[model samples]
Target: MTSSSKISRRSLLKAGGSIGLLAAATQIKTSWAMGGRSRVGVNSPEQLLALSAVDLSQAIRTGEVSCVEVMKSYLSQIDNFNPTYNAVVSLRDREELLNEAAVADADLKSGHYRGWMHGFPHAVKDLATTKGLKTSMGSPILKDWVPKHDAIFVERLRQSGAIIIGKTNTPEFGLGSQTYNNVFGITRNAYNPDLCAGGSSGGAAVAVATGMLPVADGSDMMGSLRNPAGYNNIIGFRPSQGLIPFGPTKEVFYQQLGYEGPMGRTVQDTSMLLSTMAGYDSRVPLSQKSSPSRFAGSLETKTQGLKVAWLGDFNGYLAMEPGVIDLCEKALKHFETLGGVVEAIDMQYPMDEVWQTWLTLRHFLIAGGANGLYAKESNRVLMKPEAIWEIEGGLGLSAMDVYKASKARTSWYHALDKLFDTYDVVALPSAQVFPFAAETHWPKEINGRSMDTYHRWMEVVTPGTLSGCPVVNVPAGFDHQGRPMGIQLIGRNKEDFKVLQIAHAYEQASQLTRTKPNLKKA
Candidate 1:
């Protein structure tokens, strides 16, 4: 096979398209694939967007790149295209950010350079408190809630020299999978502007996908990170719970399931961000110290002979889109080609029971938090009906219900533990389906099976969240509709490096880490 035949994942969209434009810039449309329609922009520049944080970091550190230039490039993209996708919520600190970058450049010139993230532009989900910036949790209740001090993770990023540009959008209180809220509106997919960017980290994924930033930090509870990453054709890593701390909350709300994680265009960048984001925090009692991991440094190593268990549909609770499954299956073949052992395994856990337990706990925590808001009339008016429903559900739950659900969670983890004994990793489709319409929540009927709650359709992610396993999402390949799909690479407990190793190997072997979403104007 010729070098050209070995397609890089970055250019897969152009090469695999019907027109087959290898280097023909004109034939390749620059618009993002949206809702099964490709919007071809007139006079669209041939220059593609999408960059990894690692490369951006190296350029800035070696004086080969200017932080101002980096920030300008992304800021311009956001300015030009963000209105269509609604990916960025609020960006009032442009003057402040540019000033910070100029200072960083002066420092770097004087040999006072900070490592990796120095001067690189990045955004965090609005749920995180950024000092002096409006940190709206997509609810009007906190529309004017500006924190006086930065969250610890935000502080860590700043210490490493990361430029705080703006905050991304999310659902009301980040309670839903969709990114739309009353405050900042909705975030559309980068592939197609009309479809939903899977939330509540949708805006973060879209920002990274559309080249507004090298990477973004987001919190995931349900399928937030994984779904948005898949929808936007990027990598979203939901680290082992407690790896990235969530600061003190009004209540423990979804404490077991909620996690703050990193999203980027490639596996290495995601790993690098995870390293910076992971550490024990006094602020979050649940936070655990990772035993000094080197996720970024180990990306180039060979990962042959890693044991991976490929679970097709999580025992069929969720339906898989045709092309989504086909692309992931083909990507799995690449794993075997890289000398990794792939085996089809039967997960003995009950899907219905797990879904029920997750719902019980999730509703209790979320609604319980909403209870505080319900007491305030103004806050209660801004709360979404779904949020209200959840709180009502939580109120209806008896002490026995909570106890039974907790017990079931323990039992489920033990069952999952037995499978990890035979396999080092478990692979599955990141989302049950591709990016649907911006108006819909999760897909209701998939392959003719009716799903109950908005969260019930994407049950594959529950096991990973419940088990607190390190899950790495890799852009598997695009579906026939031009929408992207991803494969979830799950590793053993605290075996984050192992998952990163395998993802890096597949990323290198397939050479698909560089695929950039064509964000043509609608």
Candidate 2:
């Protein structure tokens, strides 16, 4: 392969014309079109638009392609579909991104490769700060707030040579499981525009699924990464707490439940992104030290003797949408065929108690984080109902309630430790339901059970959050409505790489990651 950098502008325009002609001639929806149609011809720009980040990076490194060409391809796709999907919000000027890519191409030719992600276009979740780009946390209050400095992880992404394109959308302060905010409206699923794209990483997942981006960065607290990945048929890995440094915050020793990690179309791509995102920083007191290479280097481990505990619906105690359990069960059976042993496991701890404990700690964090905004009466009206509810819930907790919640959390960790002693991994559904309608803020009920709180419908993912364990959400299969679903592999605490190993093995055996959403009508 050779770089196409020298191609004349006229030739590039002619090539673009040919792509349009091919789409009309075959009546096959090109990658730029929506409504689930197949992508364009092989080796075409349309195909390049769909390459994984790993492959795209290698192409730039080896001079097989110029960074400029790659950026143009992705930007074109984003232009065509973003209006419908509402995935890539707070977008930067295109000329600026293309200019940066041109410089990257020039540097590569001069034998100055910055890193693996050199020249790749990326956007951080809106919850994180980005210098000179709108950093709205999906709240109306921060609609015009562009930070002068980047968030720690965002800085790391820049140091690794990723060209920052913009910021993706999230829920109001990332308060809900669905990605809709007063600032930018709802982010629709890439697979089906009329359906919801699970949040608060919904924008990140949709970007990856729709070829708007090859990979993205997301944060998870109560399954933000996993739920969106499950709904969009991609990979969302929430590394163990402190594995990826989180804050330059006022309260350093707080409950520490949320984590930032990578989202991608494949496990390898996700791991490759994690390599850059994970490292120690003194500013974040809880940061852990790990060699970046360990993430991608350890992907080849075999699963021949692995023991996986399948906790589908936490042993059938949790409510699930129709066909969710069956789809996940069929996906788990692939592990048995890969020489791994699968067994049914039941939780010893009461799930309702665990759910309540999670709510207490989670709301505590929310209230603490929202202290500044809540101090001003004028800002209260701008807050979402869910945010207000969480703040009040946290404020209303008594000292004894917090102490009991802490005790329950400790017990939950102990139970997980005992389970890991006998099993290599515990598997479960990433989300309780498949993608819902785009207009609905949250599921009012599931399986005839009313969801009392806004986040109650997402109980299946709370255990991993409470235990502070690493969970990887991989593609399971699709529901009858043709929407995607996913299963999560939860590993022991701080054993982030081990969890990825099992997920990679399952990904290799099932090959479900090869599936892409059909988006021809958007």
Query: Highest lDDT among the candidates is held by which one?
Result: 2
Clash count list over all predictions: 12, 12
Local accuracy of candidate 1 as per-residue lDDT tens digits, 229-339? 877777888888777777756444346778888898778788888888888877687788764358657576565676777776754545766566557766777776787
Residues 141-236 of candidate 2 have per-residue lDDT tens digits of 889998888878888888888999988989999888999998899999877888999988999999998888989999999899999999988899
Alpha carbon lDDT of each predicted model: 0.76, 0.83
| True-structure lDDT of candidate 1 | 0.76
The TM-score values for the models, in the order shown, are 0.88, 0.91
lDDT of 1 at 222: 85
The top-ranked prediction according to TM-score is: 2
